[model samples]
Target: MDYNFLKSLHIIFVVSWFAGLFYLPRLLVYHVEAQEKDAQAREILSKQFEKMEKLLFNAIMIPAMFLTWITGLSMIYLTWWDSFGSHTWLHLKLCFVVGITIYHFVCRHLIRKFRASEFILTGGQLRLFNEIATILLVAVVFLVIAKNTFDMLMGMGGFIIFAIVIMAAVTIVKKIRSNA
Candidate 1:
């Protein structure tokens, strides 16, 4: 395969992986909220959501994650492995990737919990947890694209501030909903 073609495939898989990451948690939020409904409705929603989670995890997320890794490693071996080893930005990106990988499996565990009718996390808390992947995605993309041109200290500070802002927004929205 051509280099560009392989790279494009990798990008496609990465996007798919992210799509799973984003949507699966949202489904969990819905599943959790379903508890508020009557028993029959809650049972239907939980079963549907459980099936959706399994299909999304197996059909999309896992395959995409592996393909992304395969293409990524292939690209590194074919072209930039040595340069990657020397780059601070790549190192940061790898750390984020590892973090995302952990998040991926944690979500898988969450799917199992949902399937088993184990409602450990509340809907609001799951909503907060769902934002974690987005945060990591932002960090990885910024690290790669910005490279050394971006300020590390400033970026860290900004990320902390961003998390705070997100949390505050969620809380404010919750309060508004409750009052209304």
Candidate 2:
């Protein structure tokens, strides 16, 4: 396959994936904010989220995530296998990618629960989640730009993992609290 073609697809998918990530959380904000007492409003919110999830998950995120990894690995193989081990940027990117994957699954589960309308996180909780995501994304961008040594890359990766763990723990606690 043509390297350029894969590169193009990778970029497109990545942009789409990020779009979905940015917008999905915002949608969740609105969805959770809608009063359950207002049937029409609640319905509208639910419908909007469901629609977003379908497009974001099926059309954008899923495909992008796959293509991003595929193209990334392919590019690595085609161009950077020898350099990969020594490249700090690539190492950092891979670690963040793992973080992204974990967060992706967590988001998927959260969205599913939201679709089910089982519970709503408080605005504060949602905000916290948003902040965590934003910071991790910033770190990813930084690593992409900086591309330092493995030790530095691992430090950033560690921070990302910590952020993810905290987010996941908060979400689980919220779920338990809501159920209670």
lDDT of 1 by residue, 91-156 (tens): 778888989999999999998888888989999889889889888888888887798898999998
Clashing residue pairs found in predicted model 2: none
lDDT of 2 by residue, 4-47 (tens): 88778877876777776767676677668774548987787788
Question: What are the per-model C-alpha RMSD values against the true structure?
Answer: 1.4, 6.1
- Separately for all candidates shown, the number of backbone clashes (residues 3 or more apart, or on different chains) is 0, 0
Worst 10 residues of 1 by lDDT: 78-87
lDDT of candidate model 1 versus the reference: 0.89
Candidate 2 error regions (>4 Å): 1-5, 149-180
